[model samples]
Target: MKTESQLNIIFVPYLSPGHLNPMIDTARLFARHGVSVTIITTPANASTFQKAIDTDMNCGYNIRTQLVPFPTAQLGLPDGAENLKDGTSPEMLGKISYGMSMLKDPIELLFHDLQPDCLVTDLLYPWTVESAAKLGIPRLYYFSSSYFASCARHFIHEHKPHERLVSDTQKFSIPGLPHDIEMTTLQLEQWVRTKDEITDFMNAAYESESRSYGSLYNSFHELERDYEHLYKSTKGIKCWSVGPASSWANKSNEEKANRGHKEELAQEPQWLNWLNSKQNESVLYVNFGSLTRLSHAQIVEIAHGLENSGHSFIWVVRKKDENENGDRFLQEFEQRIKESNKGCIIWNWAPQLQILEHPATGGIVTHCGWNSILESVCAGLPMVTWPMFAEQFYNEKLLVDVLKIGVSVGAKENKFWASEGVDAVVGREKVSKAVVELMGKEESSEMRMRVRKLGDASKKSIDEGGTSYNNLMHLLDELKSLKASKALEKTNLKI
Candidate 1:
């Protein structure tokens, strides 16, 4: 089974933008390094990766897509509602999880036919571990969060420090991690609190991850060298922190140091050109990734905050979100901002990477999503943390506490702003101050320098002979060795 014809790998991503994007980047990374990569996802999610896959193939890299029908009818979901981003409500999100779980049989069959050298999958597909084992292939669990979050989760699972606390709102120290990070019980994920169906799924996922050959994370060693080493020492899992995976997008342009950020550029060429016309480090970029909905009050506050901060900004307001409370208020505010000519409102879907890379961009007001965090680091932009849900609060801790490159807008209570009412809206005054501090203050100059250094390190990480580059090479060698050993065992059994 060990063929010297280039190594082939299968990547199975969960049906969420947060999960699929980084894994797709990692798949492309492998392809650029001479590995044959096939990314398998539902038909609905397939289009998101198709353009990148086609681009890679045209460049003569071995990358392709395999689409399976999502169980929309079986799961009572609407047509084409395969991804979490498609879910209109929390109840629908639960349905998406149910639908993803139903893919076990189909994925197993595909594994039987593809017979890849190794399996790489999102943590959601726990059954893939068994599937890989059945086919005599190794499995690597892909974690798309920060090493700090990983270290916290790993320790929290082992220790149960929260059990001793009385209230869910009470703050507690995360035990066993190298960092002195403290998060409220409220900030901890819902699954981490109780034993529900979601908890059950997570337990199965963690069990499968532990049983697999190793874990792969979208982080680089230099970013969290201490937590990186601490994770391996504590978990005893063969782990690879060959990431800041957004950097992988640049690996193909080994010649042009500029082409890696092209994936998101073509979507809005005009906006990028406009951003370039602004002052250096003068434009504050505000975007709450995709899926975090904002209430009317929240949007108005941010509008006033950005205007009051007196910094030119490019704020991305998702078109769907504009209809959430009242489009009139948003329209009026947009007109005021436009007349002032200090702000640009992207109705929906702007070129995020290109805007981030623009020289005029100074600070970011982000939801603290891990992907955004890595991208911000790559661009060397300081941030104003506004975490809305999930492990994003943990990532905020890394940004504000460990990295010291951000100021929190102080969203201490953890709840999805999508349904959580107006209590979550950070006041315009706080937002104004955070923006002013990040974009103008002398003290914030340290944050600017620190983040720029991280940006440099991130760029260095994927270049030839870099930390992530070597780690990726080592992972490939491990897979090849495992393949040869499996083939030897197969031959011996035949004898």
Candidate 2:
């Protein structure tokens, strides 16, 4: 194996914080290993990009970024649309779809100007793969999701559109997927749902995913061994699950500041102080992730559940109140807490990774987003999963069904109750039971052991001489090997 490196990779990610974080972290990893990287993304997400760039100094890698100009106005989004939290909206989705078209030309320009060795990109961006093929650069798909999500996407594309594809109430097992991954329409997230023309669009994206050279999942092979051979054999693409990438990015902000970077460390001293007062595994860390929003009544129910459960908890509430811009939700939530006097700390945001890594953190009560799920797994924390939408339901299945790593908050039955802002059908009794069970020593310890073991395997997979490390090497080798092929060098459209 060649020890020295000579590759310059262009990193492109789907412009969301959850997607951007892991991609930037991977770029840092490549940089740490002596490979040069220039990240490609829109100017809309410049803040997170800046934060990521600033944070990279601590990881011992610094990479440059080229912000592409996007038509933010045409999509009916605000001037700073990228900064807006990721949510389900037709307008936002349209902007992304339109921006993707614009990205094609910009990416082509970047490829011509940079002449980078390879393109490392999210599988969702079709233009990246197309541009790489036209420019004859090897493109490796950097999936910010888990192996289960990747495989499911591929399966959905390869198989013809079926009844379940359109049906919301059907629960069925995927033909080749592991375990009895029983899934229902209520459990299906947005990505699995058929909304307007998105189904056809996603189908095309999946097709692109199937045609890539290789893939890198933000997970360990041991965590999803059932699909290892299937992922490899499907596209003849090298698949590597090297993840819990957070461990690599969690270095102290002080170290980063020492390297000419200002640290935006989480203001977590208050929460930590609270944790200090609790018994080990006693506090339930409640967060709905970065993107999910709850209506006023749903927030109250959550408050009710936390209050009735009679546990000292930290709840991260993104307040949604027309009267006061969500601050009211927190205020009302706090009022309930005060009346009950249960010692619940209500915050709009928390230091998610630091909180998860804290020894006193017992379990995560989450919205079941993959990023949150992986972070929980990486931090060796079990979950009380309340999935909102998108691939989250699928992720919830993998977590609760296959891995036994978490529990799911089932769906709401009454449409009016849902319209009236009910977060879960799980009443106070179920909530208390889930809390007791999740916070129980035996269940928590078992889940912790499994998650910690997976976390360790994830670290090893990314380390030198590991399965994922070798896969990256092999991918680079294949890309380098294709560099001089006359067939690939031509600028003619072959597809």
**What's each prediction's TM-score?**
0.93, 0.84
Model 1, residue 415: distance off in Å is: 2.2
CA deviation > 4 Å runs, candidate 1: 1-5, 251-270
- Candidate 1 global CA lDDT score: 0.82
lDDT scores in order: 0.82, 0.66
TM-score of 2: 0.84
Give one digit per residue, the lDDT tens place, for model 1 in 1-495. Answer: 224757889999987888888898899888888888888888768866676677789988988898788899988889989888777777998899788878888878888888899999998788888888888778999999987887788888888888898897788898887668888777777788767887888889878878898999998888898888888887789999778887567443321222322234344455666786787888999999777887777888899999999999999886666664559888888788778888888876665676777788888999999988998999899999999887898899999999999999888666655443666678899999888888885959899899999999988888889999899999998887877887788889999
Tens-place lDDT digits, model 2, residues 1-495: 122235678988777666777787677767766666788877756555466575565555647778888766766666766533633454665566666666677778988898877888886776678788876667777777767766665665455233445565656666567566666555544444546566666667667766777677777677777766667776676666656565654466443222211245445565666777667667788987666655555665666777777676787765332236346666766777656545566454566776677677878888776778877877778888876666766677788888888866664321211344344445656666777778778756787788778877766776788766776667666655665454454545564
Pairs that collide in candidate 1 are none
Instruction: Give the clash total for candidate 1.
Output: 0
True-structure RMSD, every candidate: 2.8, 4.9
The model with the greatest TM-score is 1
